[model samples]
Target: MRNGFAKTDDLIKMFNVSPGTITNMIKQLKTEGLVIHQPYKDVKLTEKGREIAIQAVRRRRIVE
Candidate 1:
């Protein structure tokens, strides 16, 4: 969700991860109801996903 509804290709490029890896991650996130993918569009976060992302940011700040 950090890329503001990023596409698979965009995420792969941004993180330098393999397409297969991204696919698996996306699949898991979707299964967990943390992400939603629209046809021909980027993947967006569900409310739960956003909350988790926000908390992760806060945690990172605290740790840093």
Candidate 2:
């Protein structure tokens, strides 16, 4: 969801991944209804996606 909803170019650059990879992931997430994309707009996470991201953030913090 974040990939589609946020500025993903930076992350792509950081990860050195191709745009196709990012697009595929985003498409998969959307297909799962974890994300919603508005035409010509940043991707937005569904409620489910937000919940998942929040939990992920917490896990990362704890790990750190």
- Per-prediction RMSD in angstroms? 2.4, 3.6
Over 1-64, each residue of candidate 1 has an lDDT whose tens digit, in order, gives 4566787788889889998898888889999999998545688889999999999999999999
Write model 2 residue lDDT over 1-64, tens digit each, in one string: 3554565575467678997887787789899999876534566789999899899999999999
lDDT of each: 0.86, 0.76
lDDT for 24 in candidate 2 is 80
Instruction: Give TM-scores for every candidate, taking all chains together and pairing residue i with residue i.
Output: 0.85, 0.71
- lDDT score at residue 4, model 2, on the 0-100 scale: 48
Clashing pairs counted in every model? 0, 1
lDDT of 1 at 45: 89
How many angstroms is residue 60 displaced in model 1 relative to the true structure, after the best TM-score fit? 0.2
Superposed Cα deviation of residue 56, candidate 2 (Å)? 0.4
Candidate 2 residues lying further than 4 Å off, grouped into runs, are: 1-11, 38-40
Q: After superposition, how far is residue 18 of candidate 1 from its true place, in Å?
A: 0.7
